[model samples]
Target: MGLLSGRRRPHAARRSIRALLAATLTAGLLAATGPAVWASERPAAARTEAAVAAPGDDWLRTEGNKIVDANGDEVWLTGANWFGFNATERVFHGLWSGNITDITKSMASRGINIVRVPISTQLLLEWKNGQAAVPSGVNAYANPEIAGKTSLEVFDHWLALCEQYGIKVMLDVHSAEADNSGHIHPVWWKGTITSEDFYTAWEWVTARYKSDDTLVAMDVKNEPHGTASTSPRAKWDGSTDQENFKHVCETAGKRMLAINPNLLVLCEGIEIYPKSGVSWTSTTPTDYHSTWWGGNLRGVRDHPVDLGTHNDQLVYSPHDYGPLVHQQPWFTGDWNRTTLERDVWDPNWLYLHKENKAPLLIGEWGGFLDGGPNEKWMTALRDLIVEHRIHQTFWCLNPNSGDTGGLLLGDWKSWDEEKYALLKPALWQHEGKFVSLDHQVPLGGVGSSTGISLSEVYDGPTDPEDTQAPTAPTALASTAKTSNSVSLSWTASTDNVRVAAYDVYRGTTKVNAALVTGTTYTDTGLSPSTAYSYTVRARDASGNVSAPSAALKVTTESSGTPSGAVKVRYKNNDASATDNAIRPSLQVVNTGSSAVKLDGVALRYYFTRDGSASVSAWCDYAAVDCAQVKLRVVPLTTAVSGADAYLEVTFAGGSLAAGGSTGDLQLRMSKADWSNFNEANDYSRTTSTAYTDAPAIPAYTGTALAWGTPPT
Candidate 1:
């Protein structure tokens, strides 16, 4: 239930801190010096180290803001963005927890990354003991005590799954108001809260997850300026709300790092274009009230803001939902060929991408694609996403929508084939029963490589009359645990020449050969503690084996955890606070002082409440009755640093008014690998040491509130 359930990585300085601790441990066990410590005796660092050292890890480094895989391949993000994490005030890991993870894994198989997660400010507000503060219209059931335990639990689950499945995430702070952006538009914190609250929110986010690579960056605030990107008032003059949008973002970026040094902050642009913008005009566009930025800076003339003042992690993200708002007649009546370019494509691209040096992250873009140029237009937009290697998180993952912005069809259990076909080519598929060397397809560009497309299909033999014994399958599963012997089987094949023998392929490495009389064979002398998957094919004198059999999976037991490490750095890719985009990465290295075999890699993260009960979960204070309203109480305890790999939040169910708390963070190492007595020594760290601002035993009092129904 803890909010800190996701996974991520860190910078060199923070990595050094981990290494120093490890080094200290090594020094304490002088047994290393006594034996001259052969490589096998050394303790293993995590995935980050092995990635950085193996020459293979170089693929993780950035090339002009884009991430490259270990194979030196540039990865184009093709995925959907989901909101309601912090935005809806859903206790992340409570009822709504794991919903996003389920959605992400489904989308990733279809090739979608670049998720834009919209956050709500209510997650940050807090009340003192016996103080009443609650947003109206919130049901006690919706404001469950589980949420108060660790506001971060949801974020934790979201990021961990993104990392596990190989997808990137963008943390977007959607609205300053309890209600989504509009009306009191451009507000930073909900309910006219202090600017300091805004800064505090950023500080909490950046400091805690700075090391996690999957958590790419932060969108400081969503749609700060009103729809108009043109007027001076559209840009903050540091007058209207104590501080303007620009000041809030830049100042927050500075303050955040003071708490967490590696922070990437992205400031978004207003919906309206500046007067200098191509789309700018005294009147709003016929289609909508607000105008798109279209490359024009609304306040450039007055304040002369330059986003480069922040760190390299800065990025500019924009939201363009043409069909969502714009009236069709403005662009075309006939709705045929040429008009699509004139209105939607040409103008927006020029202003947003061409004029702005900052990289673009299309924060939100989706619309009905039943007919007209909608499909074609989306194709053009996707092409731009690929061409620029721009990170994109579609507007949503809602299955309730009629295929407009919905990427997955039914609660992530099924795919909207029509929509998925448009994006499937851009993703990596992890589920299938075949050994495929070709998971990638050529995206076509400078120094391009062909993507391999391998599949296991049941295609009947070309000729059945020609009698010839078939070839056996190549890949087979092992029957024994400790033995290297594996049982290989094949589906019979028909060929002109007599079937000779079957060759077993272990990864790209071939391990054994056997004569194919029947359909199965067992091969021995293979090494132990190895994971091997195989596919078999029958060979004729012509050396052509019937297509390899369906791939089967098997792995040998290992003596211990593989030795390696993975390092990650998070950065924003744009300049606008509204466009804030985060990108995380991994660098693996081997530091055992000797060669070691690496099996596989895994990463995880934990999100904890900010040392206080969640503001979103406040119950009644002075005028309140906790039991009547079903509000739970969270008392202050010890300051938490690092817990286990898995952070748990167990809340006493029911509505908790203002000052309530629940939950704890914990690391998730193998229970058998360590002991219960040693759990505190190995995992527990004072949370304040890493982030001094985070309180220990996050405790707070509830604000006054009217009693409500008990939670179901």
Candidate 2:
């Protein structure tokens, strides 16, 4: 929600300065004991001690634009955000799905060194007031001992577990209230919560964890964005205390550092009107609009916050969203990946890192791992991060984000392996180091004798004797055939090493990105009476591929009559926002005597509001609890200019029997789908089996319905 909307203001008034004269004096005293004195008069033991100052401390500090450890070695923040403590639940999501310990272990195993935990002021205050309670069924998978503990106690235990796992924590003050809607309200303090209360809450939270090194940083405010003209409570000026973000940060940051100077203070940018005429670079405009909350940083170039003595502790943080969230002007208009980075990314936040002004941390950025433009955007962003060595934490580790799902899928147990594959390359631990499929060799380049040699590294597996590929899958046959789906089973293949996975293919198209470990695959969304051919191939872990197995053909039963109907269903996830997308889930039913052939289905969506249409479809057969039907989603096409658009979903070999139905063909219509979409007025949908040749269906001809109403 912090990334969706808002603008933050700059500081106007300076607070009472508290100087740490003790530390300054200590540093001055150390400087007075010069190297000459140690070299000229020190004893042998003293000389040895002088030659090697105690190994750099483990505490982290900022020097220039880098985050350095006690040893003065640069440390990159490779982490993931686990949200939900800030939500209405006020507890981490998926505690019912898996144990928090296991989740933390999983993150650590993947080389994630830190985890950003978002929390709310209300929840913290609730804990402070001893009113925080862990409801029943909330900690089903958590430690048995923590079942009856308070929210704060559970959080303390989580921190202990994180420390045991060597993972650091950054507490994010996401909202004043523990609800998703609370994030959109520009200022951190709202409703009953006053500005003083907001500061007091931070002071209390920071004071409680000041002694713990596991809790490393504090993100001052999530995303502050609103205008004086629109929402007077959310304006930014260098002179006002009520709505000025800079002023708030200075006061809050000073208090936080006073409790723990080792803590890094993360400051985010405002979304809109970031200092009317300020620009980070000449190419960026003074009045440029930041697409998401806390994304705009142009104002920083002119009016950087003065965090007093704790200035070096500052890290410029920003949030970025891809086309999936909202298709901004930069996403369209003949802009390719290079142009996007050059025109949009560079000026926004990348310039900060490039110019070495401050260490830039991408606080939030992620999208569905589905292969499409979003994937391309992710790739481009990852490449830029790698190229610049920018520190970042993937947007989330939970599976419940409505806008962008997390790195895990279904029940929050399995990893989205595709996403992991895409992100693993950009991991800082592997940066500038040669990593083999088996293990990584630190400093493992040209002449580092301590590391694995290049010849030994690239010479394939150490087991040279096992060169045989797994035998091709055999006895493949359809276990069951439906009008629109076919379930297949086959004899497992044998390998000298081990059969890793089996590949299922319809004609030449591969259906799954991740490997199919079992000897079965269900191909759905088939055309009735269509003879579809499928083949299976086996592969081993050593990259050995087997020949395709004997192909099997199956034809779906025919529909006795040509009488079927299509209807649409929708759900308004966030009805509070005027610019929210309408997620439509379609259902195709067969009213025919027999099975009906359904090679493809076409859907036309009409909008009552005056806005352009944008669509995104979801269909993955391998996904757990996923849509049972498989579809090759075509890109959106606007038929009636911007008023309406149609998207075609083609099946590999799908059909529908009499009284059978295709469960849910899910699709998302962007907020831009209608410039003025009337929530009160119901949208209409028309569908047809004839995909390529189907004519544009008129709206209100069939059944028209609003969200929550049953589709007839």
Question: RMSD in Å for candidate 1, one decimal?
Answer: 31.2
Q: What are the TM-scores, per candidate, against the unseen true structure?
A: 0.45, 0.54
Backbone clash tally for model 1?
Answer: 125
What is the alpha-carbon RMSD of candidate 2 to the true structure?
Answer: 20.6
Candidate models: Cα lDDT each: 0.39, 0.58
Alpha-carbon runs more than 4 Å astray in model 1: 1-75, 89-101, 126-151, 180-184, 225-233, 236-244, 257-263, 274-290, 293-311, 328-330, 334-352, 401-405, 410-412, 425-712
Model 2 has how many clashing residue pairs? Answer: 22
Residues 1-712, candidate 1: write the lDDT tens digits. Answer: 1132222333443234334322422222211111100111111211112211121011132233443333222334445666554434433212332244455545554456456676655565431112223322223354343233333543455555554444556677666544432223555644565567767766766656655555656777776554433233344443434435656666766675565443345666554343333333334432222344322233433443344434444555556554444543322222322233333433443233332233455666665665656675566666555443465667566654433657655534566677766655434321221111111111111112221111111011113242333444433544333224455565555442366545556565433311234666554444557777776655443223455567777765453322121111112122222211111111122222333122121121122222222212222221222222221122111112332122211222233222221111221212222222222221212212221212112211111000111110
